[model samples]
Target: MKKHVAWHIVRACLLPAVLFSSRALADCAQDFARDNAYKPHAGAHRMHERKLPLSLLDGQWVPTLKQEIINTISEVVPPNATRITSDGLFGPIGLVVIGDRGWIRANGDAAWEPLNAAESKEILDGAFTSYLSFNRMSDLSCTRAEHNGRPARVYHYKMPSELQIGSHSEITAYFDDQTGLPVHVEVEDGNPRQRAKSTVSIAFDSAIAIQPPETAGQTPRAGNADPSGRRKSLYKHPPGEAL
Candidate 1:
């Protein structure tokens, strides 16, 4: 899948932020200052993301759109694999990638069709870099909070307008208090044409591994998926090829 598409998928699974008291805000700001100084190691992580549709009502955004038709599910396995399922005209459609090779299939379809060379290249080029992008953030606000009964730090910030999906966005991120690693993220953006909300849940050191799907529910054609059909292939395109 392309980077933009993968990014959209990654945006799917997050929770909206809630306000906290002034005392909690002070502690959160202190935590942000300290945590932002050190980079924590988040090795071989996975994510489940979902995007929700929104509508405008009385000058506010609400999740009142056709929920059934406006949902997307995404799974990520860094540094080179992602799978996304979204509502399609017919039904749910699925796209998956492991390294340079990938597959696609509609809901209820038995066979997983292989992606073309062009798409495979996009998948390889669009591999995820990091779960969080904390560099050069602006208009930062934070609060101490609890997520699932555990101590949490929630940050509300504005990214550079040029870097946001729309002209502006409201971004909220939840981090583990002790680890300083991200746990969930929510991004809501609006423009004259459309409005969107997305959430993502991050899991560090996930044991679930992404593998290439079998074509037609049958075994992979031997030697086509890397030298061995079972192992992952971290294939890189030759330089100067079409991206």
Candidate 2:
């Protein structure tokens, strides 16, 4: 089994700025760092540390929002070593694996299946690597701002890799002006000529669980069947490559 880690970046841009109140903006920024920032398991190297204002955690909405984000992430990227990058609007734009050797990239219509897992990982790693590199080199900025009556923290980062040439990606976490919990996320990216935008709305007090699709009553393949009628892999890789 693959050990999956859930990672998602949400953004929004090019929209009217008059939507949010100043107070909301502050709250959202704090929540963004809190909900999204998490340390790797013990003994694991720490990548980044983001701190949240204590005031934001006092509201009941914080834990609610956190659970929603976690559930949403679990749906597309299983708990195995998975990395998901999206405009944070419509759906996932790309998914890479540390679980399997493959990946899936989206281009508006259907997703494109690459030739192999190595190719998929290469594209995902390249895109992110390029994004980080450009963010460091350019006038990239991230700030807490209000938009459309919601509090949000915006990220304006540059994309340097050839794969993302002429592209810009933005992420915004939307917090309710009255409550600190994030209600939605907006993400935008692509070239200046043509852009892809996505908005993801989160429902409070909702239960989102990640579970395997039901396959009840289905018989397992001859070679795949175990004594319990569950499907099993016919071949297993050596220990090191198992995941």
Per-model root-mean-square deviation over C-alphas = 12.6, 17.8
Residue-level lDDT tens digits of model 1 in 68-173: 2345555556566777666632235567777767776644232466776667555444335334444345567877898878898888875433223546667788
How accurate locally, in lDDT, is each candidate? 0.54, 0.32
Task: Quote the RMSD, in angstroms, for model 1.
Answer: 12.6
The residue-by-residue lDDT of candidate 2 on 1-243, one tens digit each, is: 011211213111101122222333465333433443322221111111121111122232121121123212312222233334432212234444443354443411223343265544543343322111123222334566776756665544333322155554565444444544444555555432223344555443223232221332233233421122311231121112211
Evaluated at residue 53, the lDDT of candidate 2 is 11
Runs in model 1 deviating more than 4 A are: 1-45, 57-65, 78-80, 88-90, 104-128, 133-143, 159-166, 192-194, 216-243
The TM-score measured for candidate 1 stands at 0.53
Off by over 4 Å in 2: 1-32, 38-155, 158-163, 175-181, 192-194, 204-206, 216-243
Whole-model lDDT, model 2: 0.32
Top TM-score hit:
1
